[model samples]
Target chain A: MKKKIICAVLIAAVILLSCCAILIQYFVGGKERIAYIYSDDKLVKTIDLNSVEQSYSFVITNSNGGSNTVEVRRGKIGVTQATCPDEICEKTGFIDSPLVPIVCLPNNLVIKISSSENENIIPDTVTR
Target chain B: MINKKIVSSIFGIILIIVLSSCNSQSVDNRAKESETDIFAMDTYMSLKAYGENSEKVLQKTSDKIKDLDEMLSVINEKSEIFKLNNANGEQIKISSDTALLINRSIEINKDTNGAFDITLYPITKEWGFTTGNYKVPTQARIDELLKYVGSENIILDNDNNLVSLNNHANIDLGGIAKGYAGRCAADIIKSEGITSAILNMGGNVQTIGAKPDGNNWKIGIQDPNDSSDIVGIVEVADKAVITSGGYERYFEDENGNIYRHIIDPKTGYPAETDIISVTVIGSDGMTCDALSTSLFVMGIEKSVEYIGTKHDYDVIIVSSDNKIYITSGIAEKFTVSSKFSEYTLNTI
Candidate 1:
């Protein structure tokens, strides 16, 4: 009976430790995948979510497709370039969150950035 | 032995369920769904469409339109617009949707130099364009109504959310409202993770991502001479293309003269020009829609010159002769239908 209790305690400890490891990894490692903008499986831009001053304006495109010159400044991102008649994508204005994608339908492109990351990464505090 | 096996099985089952649930949740969080569905609305008057992240939101967007109609219909005196209009030029606080439209109208009007005037409603009312019963208003009546044609006369303060008209000017936003709705609909779709969509608001279109097959959207520009005929086609992606023409809504006089709904603000009469249709492509649907009318009224020469000097705008002018002229910027994206062998591309 004592042996069974020991085994049960050990199993429970292992499970709890595993869950903790997962939670830490998710909060830490998952963040690395988020920079500023991810386009075509590459880190196109990385942003500091906390600093309200952290903003950028850049354009990206390949030879096959037309350029999608996006402007990111003051926590807002918008399309500034396209080959289409209606600059609807530029009119989409600034998208500050990852949920709201700045998309240009005619250009087949999307620009989005992680929002909460700006809040969590403080640098000084050690999270154990 | 049997009891031990049962205990182990229960644990295993619970573990699998928990693990699977977490996996699915994580996947759901990463992927977002978005969509823009285009279809006809009111038979011939306008095209109604909505974009959303989920089917429920899309339905809600449609439902919101229905609700908006109840509030915006001129016939409904109790509606928000009617109440606002009846206030003897008093400013009225409105809902978010109405506010968004009002702000866009004001912005477009400012940007277009009164050429895209929504306050032309007074003149339009005289012509009965909104009534669907078209008639030619006399020159005297047109001149009388032209007094209230200035968009600058419409006072709007965004911070205070106040709107007032200096003259007896009645604002009708129908010209750019559909395009505004297209922009809003696209916003909803991007939130939903619907990567691919095509939104056709009657003649104005907004496309996002690409077709599932990964090709651009083929938008057909109809020939004003024949509805069955397509003058040309323009390939668009992640943008909007809108057309305005004096031929869209018009009535012929006894002299066999055609007067269309697109009245020139300067003359308070239908714009006379050989170019029947003007399609403007821009990043914003509302801008394109409003500019399409303004540039059409401005005529081919001035329109071409104006857009030529400006950056980030292009136009396709379809002439009365079935010939098409695309701006130098967008000439490459337009393709002529072989059926119209006589038609050729001209970029001046």
Candidate 2:
């Protein structure tokens, strides 16, 4: 009976610690010039902006059945084109910093940037 | 017995993690479960709220903003403002929302002495700001349109929701409509008992209440010099932060002269001011929106004089010489970026 309880506690602790590890990875997990593209709250793709030796563009089909053409340059990311009605994501131009987020409402796409050791200081949104 | 205990313990930890991140503005909220983004009023708007009935509240907020866009948009031919502007100076019955905004705009104009005039639509249209085809109106054309530049020309019958132009004039609520939409969204969310929410309506921001942990929401001020970065961050709860900058909209003529979209109702030309960027923080989004533009047009000296310890709202401006002048109301709330630390920070 004692052995069974010890094994159960060990399993529970592993599960809890793994959850903590995920939460930590979320905040400061090897911060780099990374752009996380989420579609309907699901991370669709990750791009290291610093590693891109050349510029490239691709379309991502979203949960809304619409699609956005994401353009990745050497140091920035933007929605070059989108099937979304507003094209607000494209209008967001290019964002190289986490301060700005590129969003397409109709397509339900969100592009966020995170970088460097100053990860704790990134802002939620920027007002001009 | 051990299996049951393990199941309950793991489940409890999961619940704690979820609940703890519920109102957090950190890593998880960016991936927030209850959030919506909509494009309305010629700007992109994002709403994020936590707690009960968030989806329903967000949908309702979206509907309200769409309705406001239909009612307040000047460029939309079907909008009430468009109809009223084309009414040939005749009395028109408008919605109560329209009447209230018109009245409030006049009051702001009076307080700022015409710096926040809604009657600049005719002059704005002449400069092609209404449409994207930009141009510089001749001085004669500008001066002619400037005749109808007073908000006093807008007459409203409050009880009956009636409005009319006492003189030949046109009006546009672009300045305050977005901010009003933010206020409405916040109110709707708060009414639904969702106290923790943040909205980004284009560049304007509105917070409903404190963060879930009771900390103030941290908002960054976009660096006018670089849209990709921010100049400073302000921490606040239940307030609206609106900014007006020359870099928002502008056109360069063939001669390489750049003219921003913010026209001086007084001069009928792009406002030539000592400040290039002005931000207003207040509890009322509409007032913040109006003052952001009004202060920009008022220039730095007059803006400092105008805000003059009212304590109702605060202003932060970056002068042409790169000095930062902030009102005493938000002196402790705003922190300048290290890169911008080279500039002087003046508390007015």
Candidate 3:
């Protein structure tokens, strides 16, 4: 019985160690970050967040006279101002993950992020 | 006792080896799933394929989509639609693909009782939706444009692949192009022996098969009020989920009034409805794409009635009043997110 207990504990420890190794590798390894800005459903700019040394802001204007002010800082990006009535873009703040995007419907603008390693693998289209 | 100990020890060793093999196999399978995104049809499109030949299949599918974009785009000065639109009341020769799509559109228009019309291009252009310079046309101007907004005005001669427009009507395939492209992409992926894939054209989703792990794909439904929030999620397999919402594309006027891009062919105005978004799920992408727009314009009561008559697709309608109406066919597959829990959920 004592031998059996030792064997079970050994198996459990091995499983635990493997799980920790995977977690450490995933969280500790640096990930490459990229952000894409689209205006009127057209990709207008691509930014590598890791390469952004200084924070900057730019303006995007659509054909309908609508505009969005986008700000990019280290490791993150967001829309600071927009002419849309809802102001949803401004409220979205900064996004670091590719799961969500900053969108201004009135201006027809979207900002999305993705890891550089998986950047090419990012699906071509997302529908809301 | 010694024999029992040996048996248990051997079983433990086998279990360890099995577990380790599973971990490595999962990693290998993940690497096999390949994806690519392209810009076409004035929208972002993504294709993901799973299997050993995923990379090759994805590339071919992307090229197919690009080819379709060139052939069908109304805004492209050299496209078939553009050439046909510029024909000015004269019969023009069109490719069989274009003719087939037009014929399908005409059939759908008749089914929807003119709720969906391809000849609303003049009004769409006047509203500046096509050019992104939006202007609310006057009621009188809308009346003038309405005369040209009828699908019956389009005549197709299937024998010679000829198409003509009456009263100088112009055709725009913007409403159904993505869905059509998605359908064609699925065909390509399937022909390549890719059993599992997802084709997304600006929110029009077409699944080639169940997930490789034998699970349904979980698709999130965006909240019309909050762009970042997902109001619900639906599990689906081998299906298309197409959404049409006022929030998808719109412009704010100087007076702060928001006008959506979906023009109601009957009123010559942007569709005024209580529903903010409509998500349609079906086996065919084109039908889902067209119906999402048509049902959105139909509003709540009419949409429910119309859907009851049709049995091919199911819908989830999010109304401006914060209520979600899901048809019974997909109610079991859909889960309302916590953010929208306070809103009423009616399974019809």
Candidate 4:
């Protein structure tokens, strides 16, 4: 009698967990925040904003010379330091939205959020 | 026995639902796309066009940019523009590129009441805006250059591709060059069988057509007051959107006086106007680019009054007091950012 009760309860819990997962996947699968970093027009890195668990920093250097220091938080990315003369990329601050991209002209680097593959996504923006 | 059978059947039905739902999530297949980043014309340009011929279009654009930079650079000693500026009253045989740009600039200058003067290059150079070692020029020096700051002083024999300048005037195509480049890139893309693309040159964005899915591209105009926030979004197709704002580049003196890069041709100083930024949208990228700067100098009220009823293009002007004046032509196309609800919007 005890074994049968335990079996039924286990079956119910498994079914409930599966339902919860499908619901979560349906909501989460459509809107994805992805950032692509390009140097001299070549893509160097891609970050999934939703999955980032901790803050970190990285550096991108152009072979022709010049570098940019990128700092990443859970949902945003920014340039903290740069070898570019104006440091305009650093001044642009952190960007969470796909609309505005961070560009370091001197270093020949660009960081922009990707919305092309996000089918359910709307409102793609090009910032001035 | 009956209770156990019911529970087993329910469990089996739930498993099938889960498996079917997981399988039903579609993986979309999109059209081919080619995108590349290029640094040219003193800014980073991202060119992305869809279709199989897009790669060829990008290569052609890259080559054309190199040629354009060589021909139009005022700072490059060997550039055609430099040679003409130092021409010293002699008619230098110029390329069609120089003739076309100079002709358009003259027309814009007349139309904008000298607000779009190409001859303001000397004054701009004196302030070091081009080299970025920026400083405020003395009033006396500015006044000296002001005499040479008129497009009328430019002599162009359009029949023959020859150009000259009078009164020691110098011209720089920096303001309109990027837009023209974008326009050329667009033409190239279309010629190469790519229907949709964006030649985004820094603050200047020129689009080719609607996306493959038949949706207009959404462009965000950066807030002049706050660099990180967007003022609004504009939906566009086959249009060029260019923005000019004093806040984009400026220098501050020790006394906390700020001097901007856009030197007013009349005053020979950074434009002092009620307008903080001007964004122009039109089919012709060059016109939109020149108009953005010209309108900014015209101030919020004058711009509205100047562009009233013409409707050839649209403008979104943000004033110093944080009010937004959008042209009625693009009123439906623009949606202000919710964060900007604090400010009032007046559709012109």
| lDDT by residue for model 3 (B128-201), tens | 88876778889999999888888879988899999999997999988887888888888899998989998777
RMSD of 4: 4.5
Model 2, runs deviating above 4 Å: A1-29, A32-50, A57-71, A78-93, A102-117, B1-33
TM-score list, all predictions:
0.61, 0.80, 0.80, 0.85
Q: Native-contact recovery for every candidate?
A: 0.00, 0.49, 0.18, 0.38
Q: After best superposition, candidate 2 residue A20: deviation in angstroms? A: 17
Model 4 agreement with the true structure over A1-128: per-residue lDDT tens digits: 87668767777777788788777766776557789999977899999876789999999999877999999988788999998655668767888766668888778898987643333333444546
Q: Tens digits of per-residue lDDT for model 3 on A1-128? A: 87777766765776676677656655554467889998977899999887799999999999899999999998889899888765657866777756467766667887888774443323333456
Q: After superposition, how far is residue B17 of candidate 2 from its true place, in Å?
A: 18
Write candidate 2's Cα lDDT for B1-348 as tens digits. 767876777677777766665544445533233888777887667788877687888999999999999999987898889889989888899997888789999999888888998999998888877665678888888888898889878988887888888678899999998998898888898888888888999889998888776788889998876668788888889999999988756777899998888988889899999988999999999999999999999998889998995689888898889899998889998899887899899999
Give me the candidate number with maximum DockQ. Answer: 4
Q: For candidate 4, write residues B1-348 as lDDT tens digits.
A: 857876776678687877778663443465578887777888877777888778877889888987898899997888889998998967889888778888998998999998888899999888978776777778898888888888878888889898898999899998888888888888888888788887778779988898877889887888775555788888999999999988767767799998888878899888999988789999999888888889988888779988895578999888889799998889999988888878899998
Each prediction's whole-model lDDT (CA) = 0.63, 0.84, 0.82, 0.82
Encode model 2's per-residue lDDT on A25-126: one tens digit a residue: 666564578999988768889999978999999999975579999999987998888775434577568999888788776677888887874656776677
| DockQ list for all candidates | 0.01, 0.30, 0.21, 0.34
Q: Model 4: how far is B142 from its true place, Å? A: 1.3
User: What's the candidate order when arranged by decreasing lDDT?
Assistant: 2, 4, 3, 1
Order of candidate numbers by DockQ, starting with the best: 4, 2, 3, 1
**Model 1 stretches astray by more than 4 angstroms:** A1-128, B1-54, B67-73
Clashing pairs in 3: A124-B37, A124-B45, A124-B46, A125-B45, A125-B46, A127-B203
TM-score of 1: 0.61
Q: How well does model 2 score by local distance difference test?
A: 0.84
